[model samples]
Target: MMPNTYTQIYIQLVFATKGRDSQITNLVREEIEKYICGIFNNKGQKVMAIYANPDHVHIFFSYKNLQITISDLVKVVKTESTNFINEKKLCVNHFTWQQGYGAFSYAKSQKERVVNYILNQETHHEKKSFRDEYVEFLNAFEIEFKDEYLFEFYD
Candidate 1:
């Protein structure tokens, strides 16, 4: 006899441009976002929300397929997305994601709030720098990280 297993997991993945270059210009933000969304969808991951600002990206998804680890998922997302941006000529300069990313887990109850937060990245960044906001998220989630180890961001 064969048996089936099932599981559910939710994650909010955040990453930045190499050096936080703010290279995801308004010109190609939507295109890059759609591309990234397609990657997640193609992998059968359900995306709750996705947002790409000039320097960073926020993705909230359900990791229904445990076959892939967070590290593997991030690597693929970054590599494929970078190739996509370059292939599409989305930017005058080459595009690449930073070396590290932030993956935050949340209860199902917090889904809506997280979605709204991702959707409002533009508005939120007007008031708080990405660095401050990133730090706030780390603190909120109680993740231990050193400032130097964090992604490089331009002030």
Candidate 2:
């Protein structure tokens, strides 16, 4: 009998800088994405796509670790990445993530679509503001949320 269990969970995590400040500039965006990827990989998560926008970031990963909950993993990434940015002085100001994040799950069938969406964040944001896009995701997932509880929208 096989002792291993089988499971596949795709998660897309969206988070913005504290106060939705545009601290992640083009110069450090790629480095931040790579660092975040390393954080996910260290936890044995398979990263599908990661993008760092001026004010926010989108991370798509496959979760298989039964030991760590999604919330815990996000917390680790956010905290660690914040420390990394500050330690490395990647930004002009101290770096910090907002209080909360958005975690959306997807079916295996939607993997490619989700990855494409995350990879195209730059182009997508050009047409739509992050606030609108985030609200759309909440509406699509039928998640009831109040504006006050949402990220401090600076846009």
Candidate 3:
């Protein structure tokens, strides 16, 4: 018998830089996005879309199999991006991502909608802060949250 072939899995991930400094500039953002895509490609993952805002990032990707955990993926993105930014001296303060990230699973049917939302993060964030946006994602996903851990994000 042959091993079971896993189905493609789509994930939406959101995370912000440490201290909410809005330090990612246009050129740096583009370079980081390109580097992220390269990382995903090497890992046998497909980055369908990506948008790196001033303070945070949004990514849509598909995995061929459940070989990697979401936490690991987040760590890779964070570490690589930080290293790249530091190497280039892109920002004044050292670039670092917050400790936590938010990832939500979506069906193939919902891909377009999620991509649109991510693409418009600049406009969406104009009316709300990243803290509020993070909470909204948690609430919408029906994930329980402790006020303690959540408040740390704002601080």
Q: Each prediction's Cα lDDT score?
A: 0.90, 0.93, 0.82
Better of 1 and 2 by TM-score: 2
Global Cα lDDT for candidate 1: 0.90
Q: What is the RMSD of candidate 2?
A: 1.0
Candidate 3 local lDDT, residue 71: 80
Please report the candidate that would top lDDT against the real structure. Answer: 2
What is the number of backbone collisions in each predicted candidate, taken in the order shown? 0, 0, 0
Tens digits of per-residue lDDT for model 2 on 1-155?
87997889999999999988899999999999999999888998999999999899999999988789989998999999999999999999988999899999999999999999999989999899999999999999999999999999977
Question: What are the RMSD figures for all models against the true structure?
Answer: 1.1, 1.0, 1.9
- Estimate TM-scores for all models: 0.95, 0.97, 0.89
Model 1 CA lDDT for position 60: 98
The positional error of residue 14 in candidate 1, measured at the CA in angstroms, is 0.6
lDDT of 1 by residue, 65-88 (tens): 778888998999999999999998
The residue pairs in collision within model 3 are none
Model 1 segments more than 4 A misplaced: none
- Worst lDDT 10-window in candidate 3: 146-155
